[model samples]
Target: MRTNSFTLLRQMVESGMGIGIVFGRFLQVRRESIAFVELRDLPFASPPVACCRMAGRTPTVSSEAFAAAIKTIFHNYGG
Candidate 1:
């Protein structure tokens, strides 16, 4: 079964229809039925990414400010 909806995927996984793999940040693991396991032994891992603006375009004032705020927050919260 394939779904373009994450809500359906989460629902099915929670209902035991199947296991679902999701990016850690997007996984709403608030349900008691779901347990997350880290893939500690993966050969390599990619850093998380966020895209605020496209290349060659001027960043909007709000977008630029928000991006900087996110950067500061992440930097302060970095492990």
Candidate 2:
């Protein structure tokens, strides 16, 4: 069930095997078989996400360099 493929996820959801939540920004009108429900007024707050880094361990040289570059990119992009 773990995948980064949107097409696979959408196909799975449409096949009635499971449900998937595609963000509004990513949803397209290509599939009439799939239904979308907009969720609102949740009891919890949902905040936007930034890059993620591993916790509680020393990062490898490559990882640290990658994180620094990604952080710089995010900084340049301004959130």
Candidate 3:
């Protein structure tokens, strides 16, 4: 089964629907029903992320600031 909702995916995993492969960030805490495994041997790649706004729409001050902040973070991290 495929789902777009993270909450639903987590619920299914916890309920023994099947094993779920997810990012380590999602498994922040230990759960009794779920065993966590880290596949360190696998190659790690960061997914491309975008900070986008609607085309032809005027940007708000807050939106510009947010984009600047995102740019600053990536620059600082050498992304």
Candidate 4:
């Protein structure tokens, strides 16, 4: 099944339907019926979350300041 299908299954489980399997590191916060089963190990990978601006508009000074503050917090936290 596709990742979209898995997401739909998770939604159904959240909505009280009794079909489908849901699993992930963050799913622990979900209900108890949503079991956390291990699947076969695969190479670990994820996409980066990048920030970009439109050609006509620049990010505001406040936005830049907020980003810098977040970076400073992460650096202090050893992220």
| lDDT of every predicted structure (CA atoms) | 0.50, 0.52, 0.51, 0.44
Which residue window of length 10 is worst by lDDT in model 2? 48-57
Task: Kindly give the number of clashing pairs for every candidate.
Answer: 0, 0, 0, 0
Q: Record all residue pairs in model 1 with backbone atoms less than 3 Å apart, i.e. clashing.
A: none
Query: Candidate 3 — which residues are off by over 4 angstroms?
Result: 27-32, 43-79
RMSD of 3: 14.7
Ranking by lDDT: 2, 3, 1, 4
**TM-score: which candidate is best?**
2
**List of clashing residue pairs for candidate 3:** none
By the TM-score metric, which is better: model 2 or model 3?
2
Candidate 2 Cα misplacement greater than 4 A, ranges: 47-79
- Indicate the residue-level lDDT of 53 in model 4: 24
Candidate 1 ranges with C-alpha deviation above 4 Å: 1-4, 27-29, 47-79
Over all chains combined, what TM-score does candidate 1 have? 0.41
Model 3, TM vs. native: 0.41
lDDT for position 48 in model 1: 37
**What TM-score would each prediction reach against the true structure?**
0.41, 0.45, 0.41, 0.32
- In candidate 4, what are the lDDT values of residues 8-76, reduced to their tens digit? 656665564433423334334544444433323223332232222222344578757865675575466
